[model samples]
Target: MSERTRIPPLSPFEEQAGFTRALRAGNRIVVSGNVGVEEDGSVSPDAGKQADRCFALIREYVEQLGGRMDDVVRVRMFVTDIADADAVTAAFSRALGHVRPTGTLVAIAALYHPSWKVEIEAEAIVGDE
Candidate 1:
């Protein structure tokens, strides 16, 4: 059996705090909750834009682990306001398109950032050769 490997994100927040952003075990990759913060740790303006940024960050981690967006099997979205669901879904659909993965959306009071409207976490599977 091959040993599990962890693919940590290179975020200053995580790096300074000594934590990994994601872990890869065998053919599965589990990503930590990702906020819509840019590489410089700035949150976007609104839910729709944040949703798009979240997916962009997720895609970065997914590709790092030898997988694509289509390889994602599950996703969890956290939103501060229920009213943003439609906008969030629209952004999500634009990113994932027909590759609909199992998803869950929850309304939360707030996120790590004051302006962050959405946060996402995901899991993907890479088939063994």
Candidate 2:
């Protein structure tokens, strides 16, 4: 069995909630739901920009766990407002459209934070590159 590796929690709630930001085991990498909270803990009011932040963090965590964004096989996106779908989709295209990873986007009621409009999660296989 391959050893498990983890990317330490980026959010304070992760440790308290007993979850990791990302994990790698064998050839697979899984990233937890990522919100648009900036480095300073402030979130953008723009949905597209928020989506952009989520993808950026996902890419960073994926790479840190020994996988490239190109290796990502699937992605799941959640948005609190259906109206924000277009903006979120545009951001996703900009971030990972070239990789052509399968994706699912769904409209939800609300996020853990009322201000957060979107959240994203990703899965990658190291050898996919």
Best by lDDT: 2
Highest-scoring model, TM-score: 2
Candidate 2 stretches with Cα past 4 Å from truth are: none
Query: Residue pairs in steric clash, candidate 1?
Result: none
Q: What is the Cα root-mean-square deviation between model 2 and the actual structure? A: 1.2
Worst 10 residues of 2 by lDDT: 8-17
lDDT of each: 0.84, 0.92
What TM-score would you give candidate 2 relative to the actual structure? 0.95
State the lDDT of candidate 1 residue by residue for 23-122, as single tens digits: 7788888888877877776776778988998899889888888888888889899999999999888887888867888888999999876788988899
Encode model 2's per-residue lDDT on 63-84: one tens digit a residue. Answer: 9988899999999999999999
Q: Candidate 1, residue 81: CA error in Å?
A: 1.0
